[model samples]
Target: MAEPILTVKNLSKSYGEQQVLHDINFSLQKGEVMTMLGPSGIGKSTLLRCLNGLEDFQTGELVFEGQTVKADNANWQQLRQKIGMVFQSYDLFPNMTVLQNITLAPVKVQKKSKAEAEQAARQLLKRVQLSDYANSYPRELSGGQKQRIAIARALAMHPDLMLFDEVTASLDPEMVRSVLDLIKELSEQDNMTMIIVTHEMNFARQIADQVLFLDQGTILEQTAGKDFFTNPQTQRAKDFLASMDF
Candidate 1:
């Protein structure tokens, strides 16, 4: 097997005296999609945040591309460039147009030229099927369009791994499929490495190469996507699936 693109070993986190995550371990290979499934407050979102350095872990280690991630390390900024994350909220700058929003990070953080950034932004917009909305403001677009723009902004950085935190949770029911479809397309066509924290079981089963069942911070089961859904090995996982059905 090839070396994993990302590895988490004995990972744990806490908020004050309350421990939120326990000794979590997993690895993600290049071009693989892993979906985290769990009930609310299971620390799924927190795990994704920790992976991209948005949250600090109190113990364990995160090895990305073979280098350890240190919260206080000066290279954090550079390391973050390789990990792009999208949140449930669109997080778009309302003051900026779609094109400007997509190009901002590349121009400022990456120091790419305005023309270069804009060119990349346009191509990303087309990929997300929002090329016609380049000049539109966030307020002028639908929930799905805004989310797609946010995704394009993340892709503008050309990240090696993408983390999605319940990205469809905030969208309207009608809009959810479009965004999910876009992500599925990216995984299939671009072979993007992704860690998605989602409650959409069917969608997860469709795109994920692996499925991780998390409960109260610990990983209860980690297995191939199909097997995890069809033949869950743990009672906790079985109960979760049963609850989702009922």
Candidate 2:
């Protein structure tokens, strides 16, 4: 395998006296879709935050493309440009039209020309099947549409990697599948490395190349999606899969 695009070693984090993650180690190669599966409150989101430099870690190393990420790392903004994230909540600008929201960051931060940004944003919206809703405000769109626009906004940055933290967790049941389908398409079409933290085990089984089973802030098992789901080696993973009835 090639050298990993993201390398995390002995990554640990805490809140005051409580440690949320402990000695976490993982590496993600370019174009790999790695899913982290765990119960709630297991520090899955915390780990993702640390990976993208959102949360500060007191110990260990997070390296993106060979550059180490630390609490006071000065290159964060530069690094973050290549790593995009989408959250469970659709954090759209309520006042901006969908197209504006999608192009805002690229135009303002990346210095993309308005015409260029609009062209790219429109293409992304089309990819997410929301080309018709460009003029709609966030409030005017359904939960799924808002999420797709959020994804389009992320892609507008032209990131090399994407981190999705339960991106569909806030959507209605009917809307969830639409967003998932879009993500599934991303896994098929984009070469972007992805670290997805989600409870959607069925989607994980289908889209993930590798699965990491996390428990109590530790990675219990790391295996390919097929082997991990079909024949999990750890008792914790087996228990988790049993509880989910997978």
Predicted structure 2: clash tally? 0
What does candidate 2's lDDT look like per residue over 216-242, in tens digits?
999999897578988999888888999
Local distance difference test, each candidate: 0.92, 0.88
For residues 101-162, what per-residue lDDT tens digits would candidate 1 score against the true structure? 99998999999999999998999988999999999999999998888899999999999999
Candidate 1 runs further than 4 Å off? none
Q: Show the colliding residue pairs in model 2.
A: none
Could you tell me every candidate's TM-score relative to the true structure? 0.97, 0.96
